[model samples]
Target: MRNPLNLKAPAAALAASLALLAACQSTETKQETTATTVPAETSKTDSAAGPKFLSQPLVKDIYTADPSAHVFDGKIYIYPSHDIETGMPENDKGDHFAMNDYHILSMDSVGGPVTDHGVALAVKDIPWAGRQLWAPDAAFKNGTYYLYFPVKDKQDVFRIGVATSKTPAGPFKAEATPIAGSFSIDPAVFTDTDGKSYMYFGGLWGGQLQRWQKGTYDANAPEKEPSGDVPALSARVGQLSADMKHFDGPVQDVKILDEAGKPLLASDTKRRFFEGSWMHKYNGKYYFSYSTGDTHLLVYAVGDKPTGPFTYKGVIMEPVQGWTTHHSIIEVKGKWYIFYHDTQLSGKTWLRNIKVTELKRKADGSIETIVP
Candidate 1:
């Protein structure tokens, strides 16, 4: 297990700074913003966030979540789900997260001004998409940038799709149909050192991973998890073809194990696989980080190979002021940073804002958990 790093700034000083910022903003008609202070350590017992912020939003003009951040040609590009209010009520099936389009956010460096390059891809342009263009990831191969996303088809079933562009910020052109044998939500592409790329995808509950357990869609799959010590469901991974659009082989299970090399139990909500699978290589170790959905923690596991059998290590970040937690990790200029989202701007789960902060590693190689 990883050890927790306590980096606490004075609460009184932070409160005073927030008050000053709010008092200054009260004179203007703009939306209220928080002080640009680093995230401080908070009580783990209290999941709900207080007035202090871990980091400010990267973009405020539009709600964005499930950030998939990458560095291409020395700049940071974020592919995030464009969140919008549709007045739809919330449910276990996630009807309220009615995001229908995607926008690309770019910046030359961290803490720098970000540019939103308008709409990269929208539901209306994709002939096969039904609705809710969810979380996406991008990759560059053979001089072409490919956008991998999960969207429901006309049959109302979620399928992964691919779009291509010559440039990173794209008015991308999507293929006519979803990728063959793709299912569930949050498609993240990881290109390893040897140039082989793999797509890591899947999520439980509303993400519909539960329905696909039988290798076919079972709409009547039990919504509740298994009882006793039954092994929990895990995320899916597949090797990408040379074209980067289709899976080269069959989708395989990404087994997340415990210290004793046993599958995490279904009742282990605190450490089980939930959603938002991300892979990054650090010091020759493969780090598989993901959100713990209902538990609201961003945790990770370590493995030697691109495809795991990764062992659960520890939490990366605590629950933010939101119900869902999704993120990505990237190393920039010899420094590592994590990009994530929280409901700080709207206080509603569906309307979230993306943020970034530096990620530090301990001397023993375990990650230092951040409490946001």
Candidate 2:
């Protein structure tokens, strides 16, 4: 069967699909605050490893795909849409945007070349996968891996689905039905220090943050839908119970931040524009980072808590020679780095490559950008 996100066929497509199905059906949480020190420079000299920072493409010749990376068992695992071919044919329309398969890549160090372990997840295996698989985000808790992905069913309706696996390089198993049931995509999972698990999703239509109860699917039960004062870009945070299933609190808007870590006036035009939200706590402060405009640039904000009166920091990075960039931030061995996709190779969106670079903090506690 043809994959959802349209791409030219490759010799190994069928084998890759089967492998993913076998791996996905298997899997199964907390947050803690730890002190992290900021390093002085972008590049660190190490006698054993040579250099502390490097950049390489994890997956090659795919379309503009978003990536989610996490460290598991001393390895870094990346889950991104499997957009195979360099570009889509002109006549292809509708649901044939690009076919997606989830693959597992790993390395011992942050700057190493990611070795592909073939396909880890695929659409055909899941009864409801339909054809398209959009963005897939994975999180490891309690010895199991949970992968939340967006899929289009046979009816061409888009929604999010969850798959489980025992290992990061998975054989994932699908749930009976989608968790949220909303026409949503790009699902990201986050767990807080209070043992609460939350899932964040949505794009130009705005974003939603829902709490997962100990073992249930009612993310919207606690909070009433906004009666009137909703921002154009939608982002809500709901509390999750310990088991990572169900909701505990009302879903509410994500706190906005100003440049000095203070609240900013909400702008209707700016709400729907921000994309790619990732949360991290550093030095006792919570940092919420996101993408703005055409995906070529990245900006962030900070607060004392996850539900924030966040203040914007500034743009961390922009397109050096590429048009748009999608990124994730990771800290390895006392240093910070940003992993993102860039369009420099093909320049037309497809054939974009994953790039990594050292992240530096300014004297004012802001981040510095790397020019291509």
**TM-score, cand. 2:** 0.70
| Candidate-wise lDDT, in order | 0.83, 0.56
C-alpha positional error of residue 30 in candidate 2 after TM-score superposition, expressed in Å? 38
The list of candidate 1 runs beyond 4 A from truth reads 1-50
**TM per candidate:** 0.87, 0.70
Expressed as tens digits, the lDDT of each residue in 109-207 for candidate 1 is 888878777678888789899988889999999999999999988888888999999989887899999999999999999999999999999988778
Number of the top-ranking candidate, with lDDT as the measure: 1
Model 2 C-alpha lDDT per residue in residues 1-372, reported as the tens digit of each score? 111222222334334433433332221001111211222223332234332224444444233356777778877777766554424542212133355566656666765545655566677677876866766788877777888877866765556777888878776787767764334456667777666677665443212222222233344433212222343344445554454444465555666744444334324223222456677767778777766533346777777877775776777776433433466777787888777775433333343456567788987767886654
Q: Pick the candidate with the highest TM-score.
A: 1
